[model samples]
Target: MPDDPLPTHAGPFALGTFRAGRAPFPGLVTGARVRDLSDLVPSVRALVEDWDSRLPRLTALAARTDGTWHDLPDLDVLAPIEPGQILQSGANYRKHVVDLVAAEKESLHGATPEDARADAERMMDERIRSGVPYVFLGSPRAMCGPYDDIVLPALGEQHDWELELALVIGKAGRNIAEADAYDHVAAYTVCNDLTTRDRLYRPDLKAIGTDWFTAKNADTFLPTGPFLVPAAFVGDPGDLRITLRHNGIVRQDESTKDMIFDIPRLIAYVSTTTTLRPGDLLLTGSPAGNGAHWGVFLKPGDLIEAEITGLGQQRNTVRSSQA
Candidate 1:
């Protein structure tokens, strides 16, 4: 057994779903011990849905050390919550987008790499000044356990990992204002949005931009949670550190401060199209450093370890599809 199965959060406790034998139930994790919350809530989603009322109760429960608790190694840890909807923010990281823009420009017939990068930086500044966040919808079916195996689909070879910070919505609201967006957030967790780079675009149809369905929605594509650290404990969502390691080597490392559009903007933007409800998730884009940056991709037997400050860690192994 590992010394610390669950990464340490800022708060004294966090919430997750776990199973010892028959059924998965909500658990309150503090240190190496997990107290089952099945009596209070059926699942973590249910706990999150009633976050406002249950938060104080959870805090009170966490204060006690005399509850019936289970060892972290004995239970099977599942994704913290099954979200009703997943809204993904794309290219919201300044350096990440600038790097992508520079690479693409260098590949095409254009100015020198330095010129391209300079232009990209200026573009990012302008975009931050006036543009809205680029958001997309993701399937809940893509979610898997934090320690689950990621099966590389047969359609692509360049499967990449993009570790991100995911926010769980606790309230129902549409057209939410940027000022009040954080009110909708219940908790935060770590998510690795694995993508098949080779199939990200349709070669036959250049007019149409991205093929997010084929590139992102593969089964076990999104590895989420070891625990859900409530927003109150998380402090500022804009300053967390996100780090990912591939086969024991660090691949992606950056701070949430790199985000061009913060959490509020992302939540407000997505809510304009769809209602932000309890148990919904919003992925606040990824920072610089990916497989595309290192020219490396995931393969069978490869191990990926992703973590965000105060959210928790994810340990996933990559495998090829049986098909």
Candidate 2:
């Protein structure tokens, strides 16, 4: 058992993983300095694999006043954890879904924008009643540093950003119930799910709606983790504020409360398909005001900042791909 208590300051303390150089190591960010937990837990993956047993030791290390404290700014924050698999929720936010539906209606059906939006809201309500969360597989290779540069693929002209709240699974469980889903969560992190908007659908195969593989899963596409705010620290996952800023302009500003299927539901639904294990990421979908809705898309040298309350923040710069 940890003799020391969890640290608290201006905000909730978070678990982070960083590499001063080549080797990745677990760290604890307690508002001021990042306490290196390498002596206790080597990597975030190691900690997650044995989270239940290692948490006390982690707490003990975090609580200690004496240790190798690195200035937070000096540390090179990694992706926090290299998840076993990434399970992303699609069209999970009600407002975002409605926005897409409304846009589709206006363009495809020639409905008035206002009427289209209203009708979409009605459709969303029906979905809430009869729908289950949409889940998709994401390549862990898409992961990159939170403050790293985003290399936009030239093939995909409409590069877009989706800021999401990513849940890190703690315990291994299959067929998890909605009520017990939270028990599987280890921590939370910010994930910018970059998409190639134009490549999202296969025009050749109109019947096949979305091509998630080509649209997503590019290297440096998923910007994750300035910190992994523990699930215990992030109270009421449904209430956190999610925001994204492109070139210093706020694009997506909404609450997690707008999610059509909350974390528990998403986890439960996904767990029904695959076992949720430690270090597995479950990305709750983005909020409204995506690049498509705004009639704007990412260009070279564009900067994106994404954040969720208590999860810390991520800053990504878009760069033209040489390939």
Candidate 3:
């Protein structure tokens, strides 16, 4: 007896279908449908509002049927969107910072010159220095759709995996205040921020810790999707659980509540420094259990799956790279 908006039929995940050619293909969410960027932004805004108002009903509908009840087409089967930009935060988790500090101490052997310089630079970056949110951009060319294979770069032996909850900006805004940060968000998606630890830790790399752009932004480094759960479906971005599995073994198990800086703070902080545009993605920092910290790196043929409560899960397989 829930009063949620019921779909006409069950499907794999509630997806937003866009008009492509003569037919509409499932692209974003279920029940709600849109065409492209022009259609998506405005519709997403309205959808979040609707979801906020009809939470009881929507929750009932989402809970009434498991996603598996419907025959979901292969997630990889959906056409892809050219996202405007992918922005991510670093050291936003207090525990992560503690771990990084410990690692630096151990690796530098009493603060090497390079380590000192890197720490100094970190203290200056807006995203890292302010004790507020720090943001970095990922190359659009690095994006891969859900279920795509993530290639393990042969150049590095210490690869790592981070499971992060990512927000898709729905509205364009500059200098947005923390009080109104949620208004700019369109939807939520799960992302695995894969990394090459050796490249990042290498002493010869000038950028070293300062250069997540290369260490984390390599090809296929950002694996996103399953479905962009419209913000309506997810009531509060900060009240959710994030879990990561490697080859069916749990690796990262934590919650967004553990974030040292929450979503609203992140949005307000980043927007004050840069214009956040529609299709721009913000990956809130990852929780503690990363593979590199645990000494277990991904190898070819390994499977990685990341999931967030309410939002769907993203799965990827590790492929051997010839390079």
Q: Which one wins by lDDT: 2 or 3?
A: 2
Error of 3 at 42 (Å): 14
Ranking by lDDT: 1, 2, 3
Tens digit of per-residue lDDT, candidate 3, span 1-323:
01223222123234433333454343334443322323233433334344434334444545444332222342222213446777888777655665676567657768765675566446434444356666787786777755678887667777789888888787788988878888887677777888888777547756644556657877888777655666765777777888899999898888787777888888888887788877787889898888877889988888887788876666778888872
lDDT (Cα, 0-100) at 72 in candidate 3: 38
lDDT value for model 2: 0.85
Query: Which one wins on lDDT?
Result: 1
lDDT, model 1, position 134: 90
lDDT of the candidates, in the order given: 0.90, 0.85, 0.66
lDDT of 1 by residue, 164-277 (tens): 999999999999999999889999999899899999999999999789999999999999998899999998889899999999999889999999999988888898899988
Instruction: Name the regions of candidate 1 deviating beyond 4 angstroms.
Output: 1-5, 65-67
- Count of steric clashes across candidates, in order: 0, 0, 8
| TM-scores for all predictions | 0.96, 0.93, 0.73
Model 2: per-residue Cα lDDT over 140-171, one tens digit each: 99999888889998787999999999999999
lDDT of 3: 0.66
What count of clashes does model 2 give? 0
Between candidates 1 and 3, name the one with more favorable lDDT.
1
Candidate 2 stretches with Cα past 4 Å from truth are 1-12
